[model samples]
Target: DQQVKQNSPSLSVQEGRISILNCDYTNSMFDYFLWYKKYPAEGPTFLISISSIKDKNEDGRFTVFLNKSAKHLSLHIVPSQPGDSAVYFCAALRGANSKLTFGKGITLSVRP
Candidate 1:
C-alpha cells in the first residue's frame, strides 16, 4: 500500500539526552529511506538518509538506522537541545524518482 507509519505522534526529551524516533514501512519495494526535520509551516529539510544496501547512516548529531528485514527504521538525536524541538517526518523512496512518501509526522519537544 506504500504506507509509511510513525505510530508515535510526539516525543519529549530533556536537554543533553538522547531522542529516538521510529518509523515503519509496509512497501517491500522501497529501497531508499530519508528523515526530514521541519519547522512550522515550512517544508521539511533533509536530515539524513540510508540506502537499502546500508544498515546505518550518521550526520553529526543525527543518526539513522535501517533494518530492511523488518521494514523498520529510526532516527536518533544525541544531546538534544531546545532548538531540536520540531516535527520529524519519516519518508521512503521506491525507485530512482527520489520522491518521498511521508508519515503523519512526529513532534519532538526537548525541554531545557
Candidate 2:
C-alpha cells in the first residue's frame, strides 16, 4: 500500500514566523516527493519537491527536506504570511502511475 501519512490534521502559526509540516511514508520505492498548497474549492498547486537523489530543495520562503532512511519529509515556510494560510498536502509519486498519493490534508492557519 502506497500510503502517505500526515500525522497532524492541522497546524496554526503566527505571521512572520516559521511553519513546519511533516509527512511520513511506508513505501521506500517512492522516489519523487512533492508538497502542494491548496485553497477552498481550488485544486492543489505544486509548492516544492525533492527527488530521492537530493536531501533538500528550496524556493523563496519555502523549503523541503527528505530523509529516505526514515521515510519522512517536511516542509518549512519562513515568515509565513496570512496569505499562506491554506490546506497543505504532502504527495508522492512512484511506479507507472504518475498519479500522486496524498495525505488526508492539513489546514494551516496563519494568524496576523
For each candidate, give its TM-score against the true structure.
Answer: 0.95, 0.95
Return the TM-score for candidate 1, rounded to 2 decimals.
Answer: 0.95
lDDT tens per residue, model 2, 76-111 = 999899999999999998856787899877899999
Query: Native-vs-model 1 lDDT?
Result: 0.93
Instruction: Summarize candidate 1's per-residue lDDT along 1-110 as a digit string, tens digits.
Output: 53899999999999999999999999878888899999998989999999889999999999999998899999999989999999999999978676679998899999
Q: Which stretches of candidate 1 lie over 4 Å from their true place?
A: none
Candidate 2 global lDDT: 0.92
Q: What is the lDDT of residue 102 in candidate 2?
A: 93
Mark the 10 consecutive residues where model 2 has the least summed lDDT: 95-104
Clashing pairs in 1: none
Q: In candidate 2, residue 1 scores what lDDT?
A: 61
